[model samples]
Target: MAFYTDTIDFTARPAFSNAIRGFFTRIIAAQNRSIDVERMQDLSDAELAQMGLTRDGIVRHVYRDIYYV
Candidate 1:
């Protein structure tokens, strides 16, 4: 399944808009973190070998997902 990482508010209320925006932001961040961790973990020994990645390399690559825009 696919999910949106953002929301829109047509209410034109500052507090309400801010709250909703913050909520979606947190959700997207969490989802992205989870995806990165899961993908890194799913790599097999041969796959990691092909990518020249060790356990530490996977951790480092996954951590870099936080900077994704």
Candidate 2:
């Protein structure tokens, strides 16, 4: 007579977990950039000028990494 046993994958799902973590990381980063843009918008023209930034350039400045503008 012969017998067989079933096997299970008890290892951690690093790939799936990493994907989820990456998704949340991107979301948090985007939110932080939005907050930065808002804070920059609240600054005076002179203050923005001191940082070499313009009111119309806030979004571009915050999203420079993702956008080419």
Candidate 3:
């Protein structure tokens, strides 16, 4: 008796979708971060001090939602 085996491969379809999704995700994340930074920067130094934030920490604070988990 003899047994036969076959292998299947997929290319392009999944990778293309993932690449597109990644591109869009990066764009959206950057947009969100930009908006956050702009709003924070618009604040007076006194206001930012009241909030206990600094210009240097803006990126980390903007993306804190992603990092805390």
Candidate with top TM-score is 2
Indicate the worst ten consecutive residues by lDDT in candidate 3.
Answer: 60-69
Give Cα distance to truth, residue 38, candidate 1, Å.
1.4
Question: On residues 1-69, what C-alpha lDDT tens digit does candidate 2 reach at each position?
Answer: 998779767566888899999999999999999999999999999999998988999899889989998
Candidate 1 Cα outliers beyond 4 Å, as residue runs: 1-16, 19-23, 65-69
Q: Quote each prediction's TM-score.
A: 0.46, 0.75, 0.62
Residue 13 of model 1, lDDT score: 92
Arrange candidates by lDDT, highest first: which order? 2, 3, 1
Error of 3 at 30 (Å): 0.4
Which residue segments of model 2 deviate by more than 4 Å? 1-5, 9-12
Per-residue lDDT of 48 in model 1: 85
Note the Cα lDDT for every prediction shown: 0.77, 0.91, 0.84
Candidate 3: residue 38 Cα off by (Å): 0.6
Decide which is better by lDDT, 1 or 2: 2
